[model samples]
Target chain A: MSHTYRYPRPALTVDIVVFGLDAEDLQVLLIERDGKPFRGQWALPGGFVDVGESPDDAARRELEEETGLSEIFLEQLYTFGNPGRDPREHVVTIAHYALVNLNEHDVKASSDARNAAWFSINDLPKLAFDHSEILKVALDRLRAKVRYQPIGFELLPKKFTLRQLQHLYELILDRELDKRNFRKKVLATEIVKETNQFEKDVAHRAARLYRFDQRKYDRMTKQGFNFEV
Target chain B: MSHTYRYPRPALTVDIVVFGLDAEDLQVLLIERDGKPFRGQWALPGGFVDVGESPDDAARRELEEETGLSEIFLEQLYTFGNPGRDPREHVVTIAHYALVNLNEHDVKASSDARNAAWFSINDLPKLAFDHSEILKVALDRLRAKVRYQPIGFELLPKKFTLRQLQHLYELILDRELDKRNFRKKVLATEIVKETNQFEKDVAHRAARLYRFDQRKYDRMTKQGFNFEV
Candidate 1:
């Protein structure tokens, strides 16, 4: 008996939503495409996945290649595969979200990409492909994850003030969190450790700095303690 | 200038991990294929998705066709797109898990499927394709989900005893939960309403039955009540 098998192949790409906090505003990194399909159009930093790398690795590599940033907290958000999403061809993109501290990287925006820049998430321009939808999904996941996990620290600097932490929560949750209530809840979780330091240069009084105590959090978590803020 | 357009497309398929919980053990539904690629071998219910239907809807339709069961709680777990996952083609499958009450459906083992049957999760045979890995991922998700959410109820009857509920939790968590603590946690959440019904025709002391109060749970959930069992 002879059998014929038809190979089914799909073009796979990875799109990353790199989020950063900049001066009380939530921002996302985007790139202007330098190639075809959407030349010169603004889009998420992404590209086709290579042969052997996993989708997560592809997302990280694309982000690094375009922005020179890595070692950040990244997660797989979703896979966007609507056949009509890409007008030029059938591209399936695995969307990922990366949280980075803006202060750590100066963002050499004109490297591999036509132009890389940070845009306030609220003030995003019309993006190429289905990036708008992908951004929305990433934001939703970020909000949900922030509520249940300690991932919000990823968007903050290594050492931050309680006010900054509260602001980050307010930005993600899109609401005004009472300073007293926010600090009370966050400190009660015991995930933050007070540092013997303060902000270097600021107009107002420099509040005491704190760092995410991952070791203590991990130990407590293994002992069946829940983290909520 | 002449323009060449590259159409981007991803090969899409739907895979379902149908889980059933008999009184004693957790089982997954598998089918014997009558076609090539894995002809005559047992596999998970799946097929290439058709145009005009969402991958989620395609998964549901495939489950119904291959298992003759519908109206079950189905959730999109993850998309599996490892390059070598499918030997016959470069296929990316959107894997889903469906929880059905075993008592509700008859064992129509050969309805639309060549040969379909439920196998205990522990003693599953060498499955066709990458189904074994898919099954493992689904089970991991189920185990994690059962801890913080009330989805385990989907595998139970509408009216269930406290003991049955406890057994389901133990089976999913693979650990024994103290009965008193379990009852206190579940009852304190107020998601289960006592039905004033008792088990009939039992050899031992009959236990009172209860039903999940989804409406109350929904309202309480909106009010930020966390349900953990």
Candidate 2:
């Protein structure tokens, strides 16, 4: 009746891929490493998982400690466990991804984090360890998830123009969408509500703003009203 | 700057949730335990990760050894690492799920698996450890994954009738869809191709069979074609 182990265990860690959307492009949060193997290299914000905490808890804690970020939409991405992935013995990392509006969190490195900064996905530097692979996986997941899930809201302000929403979709999907068809399909879904407001502080005529109705989306999801781009 | 760990590491394992679709229902594979901590209780098919093996490799190896199923569409589900999840010690298992057509493999109690059987997802027995939680996550992932990804093909025969395809969708989605709407949407995607064949062993008039065109689907995916049900 013994399930005891004699083999050595791999050290577990948690990493976070914090994605942010700006006016022009999609960006990811990276931190300059303070210590060795890949010292001074940019990497995703993360650290080792403590013995007492769950991976979800560890992900949140590591993200906050490394980047001064809290209360964002975090999701488990994948667990990377190649034996040679880390130079210092056997290590396995459980990766989590997050989406945050650029205006919300002012990114700064603290605690064990050296210099946290947002890098455009297309213009990222050579990352530490297997971080580039992790970021790639996170981006793919985000692209796939944003279509069917209401995750695009996580990257936008509370009220936004239809053009902005369409832009977000285009950036993640990495293609140009037919504007007329996109507007027609999105409006038909009824998930986005036209607000009684317009954009302010613009030189040109302001566009109308809209909000994603979370309550309606949840109810419709139960009834199988799929949201697609 | 030593980045080495002094803390004891928790043992790592890989567990699999093998989902299969039969003629009448959707099912999950469970294996009876031959060794302790939960002897004779049904649980997921899995084992510890060897030092030289990746989690993906370990998952496939464990699934084959435990269930005698191979070469199915296995993907990493999640990592289960709640403290006290395993009573014997701290064992965090990386879970993987696979979609299989029941006709391909016969279930038996083989290897370390004492007895392997398929249980209807709606009527599963009390499972060992946190296997119920793992199964719940897998089902949710499958439900979400089925809508956007062409994963449903893994659970179906290569050639099937439209009725069977619709039925599978209904079962996974947990609701019935309009027949005409379903046909129109699926056909419009052009992912399914009509085979020059019909059901051979039916009492009534044989219905035409169709196959999921994976190559076409991949190419269309690159061109921003989405698969929805």
Interface RMSD of the predictions, in order shown? 9.9, 8.2
lDDT of 1 by residue, A74-117 (tens): 88887777768887655667788999999987678435736899
Model 1 TM-score relative to the real fold: 0.79
lDDT of 1 by residue, B73-114 (tens): 998877777767777545677889989889886658435837
DockQ winner: 2
> For model 1 chain B, where is the 10-residue window of minimal lDDT?
B1-10
**TM-score to native of every candidate shown:** 0.79, 0.84
Error of 1 at A222 (Å): 9.3
lDDT of 2 by residue, B1-229 (tens): 2222366567789999999988778999998888898898999999998776789999988888877788888999999999889997777889999988877666663565268889999899999999999999999988877766767778888888888889999889888899999999888878899999999988999999999888976775454444455
Q: After TM-score superposition, what is the CA distance of residue A186 in candidate 2 from its true location, in Å?
A: 5.9
lDDT per model, in order? Answer: 0.81, 0.84
